[model samples]
Target: MKLTVKEERCSGCNVCRVVCALHNAGAVQPSQALLKIKGEFPDPGTYKIAYCNQCGICADSCPEDAILERDGEYNIDYELCTQCLICIDSCPFDVMVVTESEYPAKCTGCGKCVELCPRQAVLADQG
Candidate 1:
């Protein structure tokens, strides 16, 4: 499964970020969210959503074998994680984040971001 974005439908409301941070990290911090929105106002005037595509580059790059796939979803096994940033660097979209807790944060394909998008700009499905 992959999370797809419809940039044109995004209103910059940031609901997806809020939901992601709250659902995954139990906080309201956008910086800790797995996905990010990048753009500026009154110039290009477009918001670009960046998120995991479940490409497995992170899993393949992990020397500790911390990342694993289960039931078609990629997840990190925190006990096996060595706080290495290899997965973070391997992410093509730069969506993987290293939290203040020293754990790497990647999408679990939970669909929280997609479900909370007010504009329906984010979608998760078998791609």
Candidate 2:
């Protein structure tokens, strides 16, 4: 399953990011979120959302096989991770989070963002 966003419906309020950050990192910091929001200056009312599609590119890029998928979410195995940071370079959506934990942040597939989005713009494509 991968999260999808309806860009037209998003208001850039960042409720999704706040929720993701809180759920994943225990903080309200948007930068810790597994998803991203980019402003569209030309159209002030709309924003673009970037979230991990679970494509497995980061997992494949890991020389140590640290990244793995479980319950449709990709996460780093800290015990196996080598701090190579190659996964960060391979992310197409640029959502890989580098923190002091020495592993990249990933979506927990907890569905909190989908349930809490005020605009109903976030969705799960559970293929």
Candidate 3:
């Protein structure tokens, strides 16, 4: 499953962030969102959507074997996670973010954020 985020249509209203936080952490705050939006102020702002690309870098970089590549995707075993921040630092996309939950949160390809996005910015495509 590949998640695609189209930035051209994003309004930066933060609907996707709210949805992500709600789905992953059962909260309404955008700061808790796994996905992040970075942009500057003013008209014609260039938005950057950050989310896990489902890449296996974190799993491969883990020395503790806490991260695993399962069914072609990476998943972290919370019980085994020592909060080392290795995976968070290893993410090239800067998608893996340290949330209020302590451990980093990676996109689960759940499509909840995609569905809740008002701008239709995020999408889950399985090939």
Best by TM-score: 1
For 51-74, candidate 3 gives per-residue lDDT tens digits of: 877878988777788887877777
- How far does residue 59 in candidate 3 sit from its true spot (Å)? 1.2
Report the C-alpha lDDT of model 2 over 3-119, residue by residue, as the tens digit.
Answer: 887888888888988988888888878888888988978856568888888888999999999988887678788889988899898999898888657677777677889999988
Give per-residue lDDT, candidate 1, residue 112. 91
Which candidate achieves the best lDDT against the true structure? 1
| Worst 10 contiguous positions by lDDT, candidate 1 | 118-127
lDDT of 3: 0.79
Which is better, 1 or 2, measured by TM-score? 1
Model 1 lDDT on a 0 to 1 scale: 0.87
- Model 3 clash tally? 0
lDDT of 2: 0.84
- Which residues of candidate 2, in runs, are more than 4 Å off? 43-45
lDDT of each: 0.87, 0.84, 0.79
RMSD of each: 1.5, 1.7, 2.0
TM-score of 3: 0.85
